[model samples]
Target: MHGANIVLNGCSDRGRLDQRAAELRSAHGVECLGLFANLTEPGEVDECYRQIFARFKRLDVLVNNAGILQDALLGMIPTDMVDRTFRINTFAAIYNLQQASRLMTRNRSGAIVNITSIIGTNGNQGQAVYAASKAALIGLTLSSAKELASRNIRVNAVAPGFIDTDMTRNLPEGKFQERMNSIGMGRIGQPDDIANAILFLASDLSAYITGQVLGVDGGMLI
Candidate 1:
């Protein structure tokens, strides 16, 4: 959709990926390649990048959107929950960015977007570890931006508020209204809202923007 050949990386859902790839080809004539890899595995990450380069030969944009949320309060939080959250959300993102930056630096031009959460910006109850892991990405975004800028790679983050997704829908009914009240818009955010912000950061429209966390929360903090 953005005039760049897209390679979507996912850990599973091959059937869905194939369907979307066919849809993109049929609707927009876009060549979309979907690859599945366990992003938490360093070896898998490396192989995924190897496949990407073999096919695309170059990398331009990276959207680090893979994450998992397991909500639990401080004392009751399971150790394994923390490990899974950090592995999927923080570590895997670093692995992907590390690989993507290497390829982009060769061309001296690229954009990277990390999808964080509004809860990361303003911590919420029962999400201590989840928030912490996401906060790490903000630090990663800023630091990576400085390190990669000289190489002509831009790094940014998008913090989404309460969005209508299966993940959020699973939250307790009380949480739903609690989030709505927090947002000045008084409405739940749509996935497209986050996509638009990422697109801006990934495109030339934000050529001069980097090392920044854009909140796509419908004024949730305000």
Candidate 2:
């Protein structure tokens, strides 16, 4: 908990966001603003940015952590599912970065962390759509980092390896065990493990780092 002012965007569940905001406020004394936006819509994204800037005036760090999984074999994957995956996972980040970078470059300093996946690099059996989207995001992180470096804006990615989030927990038990067994650590990575990596990338500690993907996957790639 860095105790910074936080604006959460693109949430459709206002009640849950509000409850989480209240909890964060009570625990860390941090101000949290929850805003709703259909991230797939460019106009909604612009409106969300307007609200964020109007309220906070400045954005120190942005974490592009929104994504969806439509797991299907490459041949079995539907056209719409692939499009939807990219719509939320890849295009949404591009749109958000367009708005965010304009502000960050104006100030000449900021950090952006994109949440990716190990599947992007290593590939998986039934994750063609998800993997392609994440792979695209990794490309975006690198290209954006170089493009924005002159303005003192840093862009990096965190590739979580089978982290224990809502997405992973819902996997079939047998598949989950197989994945866990493959991990060198022999355990699922907790959410905080990834959060800590993002925190470092977003902080002054990583001032010299840019255009890199830090894997928080309990040695899955190794």
Candidate 3:
């Protein structure tokens, strides 16, 4: 932990968001704020950042980690599912960057780390839409990095492998084992694994690093 003092989770579900914020406060004694916004809405995203700026006075680091997994094989995939996936994964990141960079550019120094998935780079079976969204995010990172470099803003992304989240936990038994075996380390990643990676990229230690993608996949792709 960077001792950031403030931990915010941007989610539409205020109940769960508040609960997670409370947990952060109770566990680490850190002040966490829950901001509820339909991120797909550009105005809402702008308003959310306004609230953050009002509280924090300035923005330093932003981790665009909000996403969803709507897994239905292409062709049969629901149209709504495709729309939702891109809206949350790709378009929302762009919106957030627009707002975050607006604030960060004022300070002329900040780091933006987007949470892309391994599927983004590797292309999964039932995740074509998800992959495309994340792939677009990667493009966004590179362009934003170049555009904001003059402002001393650094942009990067982390592509996480099969981490043990609720989303990845319910794979059929055979599918689970298949994924487990694919990991060279023979273990699915933990949230901390990805968090540590993000910290490294966001911290001053990586002062010269920008417009890059760090794959925290435990050798899954290899």
Candidate 4:
């Protein structure tokens, strides 16, 4: 069971985003604080940091898991959709990393796990914008790892493929099934599968791992 004091940012008002995280913390006897910060807005992100710092005085790990998808073929993709996706998926993570890493540097030890996607590594047909944004995050993960390693901070990413969450459930059944069958495992992944990997990267077990992208995709890429 995990017994770490954790903060969940970029959570939604209805608490859906952090429901599983909170449950996991309770089951594991860990202290979990949920912050409903809209990562797309800088002001909200800063306020969320203020609250977390005010309560905990320090942060040990940061998981940038907030993201959005606007799926359309490149020609059909709206300019505004592309802009919004980049704003939330890419810019938000960068801003949070900047602020959170500053705190981690003071302490000289921390782990930052970013949630990317397989689409990022192998571009998908209708997800050009989303994939591009996630690809940028992977790049950021590597560069930040180099920049922060000297401070004893580790930066890494997890790229999940066809995870079964509300986001995927909302997709058309035929599309979802087609995607799942494409994977060698012949099934979609559960959120816990990805969450467990996140827990590992956040814990000391992965202390030696950094600047790496761990794919939790059931051999989809292979």
TM-score of each: 0.96, 0.95, 0.93, 0.89
lDDT of 2 by residue, 49-101 (tens): 88888988778888999999978986899999988999999999999988899
What ranges in model 1 sit over 4 Å off?
Answer: none
Any idea what lDDT model 4 has?
Answer: 0.87
The CA lDDT at 127 in model 4 is 89
The 10-residue segment with the lowest total lDDT in model 4: 8-17
Mark the regions of model 4 whose C-alpha exceeds 4 Å error after superposition: 10-30
- Candidate 1 yields a Cα-based lDDT of 0.90
Tens-place lDDT digits, model 1, residues 1-222: 356777877667888887887777677777788887899999999999999899988999999999988889889999899999999999999999999999998899999999998888889888899999999999999999999999889999999998999988987889777778988888899999889999999999999999999999888862
Measured by TM-score, the strongest candidate is 1
Q: Given candidate 2, what's the lDDT at residue 29?
A: 86
Go through the candidates in order and give each one's C-alpha lDDT. Answer: 0.90, 0.88, 0.88, 0.87
Candidate 3 residue pairs in backbone clash: none
Which regions of candidate 2 deviate over 4 angstroms?
none
Which 10-residue span in candidate 1 carries the lowest summed lDDT? 1-10
Kindly report which residue stretches of model 3 are placed more than 4 angstroms away from their true locations once superposed: 26-30
Give the lDDT of residue 105 in candidate 4: 82
Q: How many backbone collisions does model 1 have?
A: 0
Between candidates 2 and 4, the one scoring higher on lDDT is 2
TM-score head-to-head 2 vs 3, winner: 2
1-222 in candidate 4: lDDT tens per residue? 246676776454646647866786878777777777777788888888888788888888999888898789978988899899999899999989988998888789999999999999999888899999999999999999999999989999999998988899998989877787788987789999999999999889999999999999987752
